[model samples]
Target chain A: GAGVSQSPSNKVTEKGKDVELRCDPISGHTALYWYRQSLGQGLEFLIYFQGNSAPDKSGLPSDRFSAERTGGSVSTLTIQRTQQEDSAVYLCASSLGRANYEQYFGPGTRLTVT
Target chain B: AQTVTQSQPEMSVQEAETVTLSCTYDTSESDYYLFWYKQPPSRQMILVIRQEAYKQQNATENRFSVNFQKAAKSFSLKISDSQLGDAAMYFCASKGPSGTYKYIFGTGTRLKVLA
Candidate 1:
């Protein structure tokens, strides 16, 4: 419970279905980030939320992939019309939002699209 | 655009021996930081080591150390006293002064420790 936590450690969904993955960052950590780890693509940044500032969605692959952090704490990543390629380990991390601060990660959610 | 590259796709080391995983990057920011993370079959991304570009000294965490060459834009992870637990996928990442502070990660190198 001390480190970042995620719900539904494993998720299996059918193609064209929608799935929402949740993440709860460490308390007082203002910077929260989402990353996807695929077989060959390695770790890819998905989105980041820092304090109350606007989230940087530049890493999002498409409009179908979106995320939002509420109350600057819990966040959810939603994939609409999930495809087989959307299957991957979704990781969540939290940092102090300061310069050169290291990120603390959670046990990622394994997503499988059939 | 910031990019990170890992030329070594796989590496192997005998137990108690040493191994090095190579990484390179291209960034326009004057100030940046580099990090190494390990992901095992468990799928947890654990931070291994971090090196700041401003520091000339490389970072060392017990058996895990890094060779940081700022001029060459190279960051390599060196694992000493390799153990079975050290077998995992190592990723080299860089975060520039791009306001968002998003990391650019390499394709990663799979390291296997032999008994």
Candidate 2:
């Protein structure tokens, strides 16, 4: 009955540092996704993981953004060498399958790079 | 290229009234899906309604309904009996049929409900 959940609702880090955001998808959900939400902007796709298949990293803005889902459940998105432009909300979502029409979203982590 | 557009950045409606949020999208795939998601101050994306490309009939969910114009590549959300709780940011998204379910989202429309 629980929905998707993310940790560190808010995170503040200095420039050039590294930070990791966590996401716990719904039970039995085999598909997970990450997105970035800049202030006053739309949601930008980040990365995706579906079952045991290779994750889709095309949406990732740069090599600094990487994510991995272990045991097919929890996912962690790590941002290396954070910059001020990285200040945004990181959102995670999950669906029953990779092509499932509907996706359930998490509360999101508000990351701030100073 | 797949793209969703929300022309209206903001809209206002009185309580118990009706308001329509416009959305249009362009894609090469004929078999696709459109969705409307609401995001309140809580920042959680909640599905409001969805429409399948093959379905000629509009999709309705309680007070929420969509006008799906396939030819025009438009899917607009019409909210009736608007309530204060319905006030939030509405986003229009479109996704292809296969490969991945990643959706192309619009900039979003901020709806303000006046009591």
Candidate 3:
């Protein structure tokens, strides 16, 4: 009955550092996605993972952004050499096999790159 | 590429009144899904309603309803008997039937419900 969840609701890091955001999807959900929300940009899809298939990294702005889902459940989005432009809310969502089902979202992590 | 548009950046409605938030999208695909998500101050995205492109009939969820016009690529949300709790940011999103689980979201509309 639990919904999607994310850790470190807020994170503050200096520029050039690396930061990792975690996401815990709902049980039985095989599809997970990561999106970034900023003041300038609305909500932009970052990556998507379905079961054990290769994740969709097409939306990654640069090579610095990467994500991994361990055991097909928990996902971690890592940003290398974080820049001030990376400051935004990182949101994670999950759905039931990525069909017509609705995707449930998490509270999100507000990352501040100073 | 699919694009969702919410022209109204903000809107207000008195309690128990009705308000309609406009949304339009551009997509070459004929079959897709349109959704309305609400985000409160807590910033949690909540699904309000959804419409299937193939479904001619509109979708309704209690006080929340959607006017889906496939010809115009328009999907607007109508809230009746508005309540204070309705104050939140409403986002319009579209997902293509291309088997990719990506959703394109609009800039969102901030709705303020007044008593």
Candidate 4:
């Protein structure tokens, strides 16, 4: 089976610029999630989508961060006006559903705000 | 809100030895799931083991096992006969029951295997 995949393994951008990270979840996966991991820090939850229900944006750090899951298969995380503090590895994961199932993670996109 | 904690920043164990990584979480929900994820230098997260709060028996996979104490809110991973490939960052995570399946992860513990 194909695993979760992310694009632009490494991204370098200037401060205040916007960046869009893409994620392709496994086939038939109905749950997708985005998280950020800073150096020496834990994985910070960003957003989550379950089936066609409303996406959970409670973990979004700010309004500048947003995500959209199109057709319930792919998801894109956009960071508008990125700041230096936003430099980290953006990870995406997908699951079959809820039900305490294991979440498969992608390689992640390392965003560097210079 | 739920929180996961890994008290050890790093740990080292010799090959073929045993090592345990400690994890604790704070959550009001009684029924949830605890997981141990391993991230190697390649930066890919892999599911190591999982324990359901409702089950009293611990979860074990090959040489990897978990000592889950629901009452104390503690979940520790024990690796017996550790191998070099086991060297990686171990993270403890918790997923609340139903609703959104977002995972709350710990700070992670770096494990080093020595020959």
Count of residue pairs whose backbone atoms collide, per candidate: 0, 0, 0, 0
Per-residue error for B107 in candidate 1, Å, reads: 1.0
Q: What would the TM-scores of all predictions be?
A: 0.96, 0.98, 0.97, 0.97
Q: What is each candidate's DockQ, to 2 decimals?
A: 0.64, 0.72, 0.70, 0.77
Off-target runs (Cα >4 Å) in candidate 4 are none
The residue pairs that clash in candidate 2, if any, are: none
lDDT of prediction 1: 0.91
lDDT of 4 at A25: 99
TM-score of chain B of each: 0.96, 0.98, 0.98, 0.98
**DockQ ranking from best candidate downward:** 4, 2, 3, 1
Q: Could you give candidate 2's per-residue lDDT for residues B1-115 as a string of tens digits?
A: 9999999999999999999999999999978889999999999999999888989999999999999999998899999999999999999998898664778999999999999
Off by over 4 Å in 3: none
Model 3: pairs clashing at backbone N, Cα or C within 3 Å: none
lDDT of 3 by residue, A9-87 (tens): 9999999999999999999899999999997456999999999899889999999999999999999999999999999
The fnat scores of all predictions, in order, read: 0.68, 0.66, 0.78, 0.83
Top lDDT model: 4
lDDT of 4 by residue, B1-115 (tens): 8999999999999999999999999999988899999999888999999998999999999999999988899999999999999999999999888654878999999999999
The whole-model lDDT of each prediction reads 0.91, 0.94, 0.93, 0.94
lDDT of 3 at A93: 95
Model 1: clashing residue pairs? none
Q: lDDT tens digits, residues A21-112, model 4?
A: 99999999999999999999999999989999999899999999999999999999999999999999999999988664789999999999
Considering every candidate listed, which one attains the maximal TM-score?
Answer: 2
